[model samples]
Target: MSGLNSQRGVGLVEVLVAVLLLSVAVLGFSALQMRAITATDESLVRTRSLTLVRNLAEVMRAYPEAYVTGSGATFTTVLPTIASAVPTVQAIATSIAIAEADSGDSVTIDGLIISINGANNCLSTGTTTDDDDNEIPNKLCSINQLAARDTLLVKKTALEEDIKLAVVSCPADATQQAIQQQMCIITAWNDTKALIDDTDTKACANSDGVYKIGSHCLISEAY
Candidate 1:
């Protein structure tokens, strides 16, 4: 009878050990699942960012004229290359997009679409004259041009604190001269993680908009 009682006690201990191991396995699996979901979400956000970058580049390529001349105040002026991609430009575009998306916010703000010279603003605002400007002859809208048309939110996408269009100039042979400029564009977004770490960033005193830390993605292209 004593031996049988001892054997029953050992059997109960074995069963409890097995249950604990199973629980541990289940917890590990749950943790892995959560990690996978986080990775996927990050990937999705990155993809969207890339798409936005590409889209802006294409837009720039199409309208090289808009970025020429006028302190960028009148149009997307072609100031000396400060950096590729202007922070203010990216911020204004994103803000305008979001505002347009939100029904309630749409009315209070002037629409992103603006009229130039009292005319509906085309993707290209004015033309680079065939004779004086480069032969491309396509025109760009200047800041003053937009003003002539309507009130704008950001006036040539300029910001007091947050804007610098990085550009690199290299000596060009004949073909290179045609595509002489490498322009930089930065796509910046508010980084919650960065904001959380330094709460004082809420002020953004140095920058006109939120400081996203490394959240900006800059792309430069010669066209």
Candidate 2:
């Protein structure tokens, strides 16, 4: 009877050990699953940001008149800054008037739509000859600035709430005209925390257009 009781006690100990091992394995698997989900979320945000930045670049290209003055002239006015806290379409639209004015286009900020000289429609080329038979120079709402503003406004409204966009001078000390003409579009979002040892507040980026350790942002250069 003594030997039988001893064997029963040993079996119970073995069962407890197996249970503990199973619990540890389950916990480790759960942690791995959580990490995978986080990675997938980060990837989606990154891809969306890339698409938005490229689209902005394309929009700028389409409205070359908004930034270009002559055959080879560079951008005269700087791009507007979009803060992460208040990423509103009207904010972006209202701030673009400087560029519009530089392009010889008078614009009025009315809500999200920037009316060039109070014109409702900007599709018109606005290229018409006056009674004097002289071609109008930089005609109002000439699809130069107004269209750009309106299109950009629409795009801004479509941005995800979690994503933030900002415009900065890339390569802060670039001397070449080509580099100087280009602007950096930064798309930033919250991701995993930095390593415990990392201690950079501007780890993601800075006004000087530099990315440091633990950065969770993407930069795209646009002209």
Candidate 3:
């Protein structure tokens, strides 16, 4: 009788151990599944953000005239509205701001800003010439036609640099030109530090907006 009782007790212990092990395995799987779901959600958000940015860029490119001449104050488009499964599509705008730098006849091209609700304000600084002229021609002429061509070159460089820096930092993810413009501003600030030492004012005059150590043009506007 004593031996039979001992065997029964041992079987019960074994069964309890098996149940505990199974519970641990189940919990581990649940944790892994949750992590995977979270990762997928993050990826979807990033993709949506990129798509929104690209759409705005395309819209801006399509209306070059509107962008250049600064015709209408605002441009708007309706995105395809989707259910909760995906992000709500939104129309975005590429805002262009041009501003004159502290020194030099060069102009800066600030990058674009994107909005989700289509109610965001985009402010851009006006571009100025060496003569302190704020009128930026719709079409840039050759150096012979107008000395402002050099300023345009500098502006273009600043815009391109902003894009490149953003691409490097984010890799596959797309970012609005706003961030890139900010980076260019910092770069421009650093470049201007040595301007006081230079006596030659003709260095960046006729050439394109490429900024060298001694001879550099400031970017006045971004499109």
Candidate 4:
């Protein structure tokens, strides 16, 4: 009887050890699953951002003059506020929203890098004062005031890519040349990225579904 009792106790100890190991394995597997979800979410958003950049490129190619400076010129990006949201602006913005919906991503256009001009140069003086008397970083253009040959060009670049576009001259072709020098449009948007902590990414806050995050602007003659 004594021997049998000892054997039973040993069996119980072995059972408890197995259960503990199994619990640890379960917890580890859960963590791995969470990580996979995060990775997948980030990948989808990145792909969507790429798609947006490409679409903007195609749109501007058809309307180069609308965005770039004439005579092989290019301008820097500026954010413009809405003076009054006109029907034309609405129509254009709507088109982009529709495209995003079709692509299964929810990011929308949030920034416009409008082109600015000054005396005989597309580049602006860093110390120039705006009408408000505040020293501005550079001349940034408005979005709503686009006119003939003026543009709202959309471009995409990687975060690791150049912050400002390089010195690229427009080709001789009239259509290509239109997006040169002082006239240009560069747009950026927000998109959601995966989060391990999920604390402060407003774009992705409401639900697990993707939203907009950072902005990336590119110029004509850029890739």
Best lDDT goes to which candidate?
2
Compute each candidate's TM-score over C-alphas: 0.46, 0.59, 0.31, 0.36
> Which 10 successive residues of model 3 have the least lDDT summed?
84-93
**By TM-score, how accurate is candidate 3?**
0.31
Model 4 spans with C-alpha error above 4 angstroms: 9-13, 67-178, 181-223
Superposition error at 153 for model 1 (Å): 14
Worst 10 residues of 1 by lDDT: 101-110
lDDT of 1 by residue, 1-223 (tens): 9978766645777889999999999999999999999778667655654555465555545444332222222224333353333322322333333223112221111223343222345345344546566646344434423332222233223222133222222123112212224544343333322111234543222223334444433333435
lDDT values of the candidates? 0.38, 0.50, 0.31, 0.34
Give every collision pair in model 2. none
lDDT of 3 by residue, 40-139 (tens): 8656544443443343333333332221212122222212131211100111111222233322222211222222112222222344354666675343
How well does candidate 3 score on lDDT at residue 175? Answer: 42
Tens-digit lDDT string for candidate 2 (1-223) = 9978766645777889999999999999999999999999889888887877776666655654343222111112322231122112222422432343323333332222344344544555656788999887544444344544554443443243355565544655343333124756666677522111125574455545556666777878777
**Which candidate achieves the best TM-score against the true structure?**
2
Shift of residue 101 alpha carbon in model 4, Å: 6.1
Q: Please estimate how well model 1 matches the true structure, expressed as its whole-model Cα lDDT.
A: 0.38
**Candidate 2 lDDT trough over 10 residues, lowest sum:** 68-77
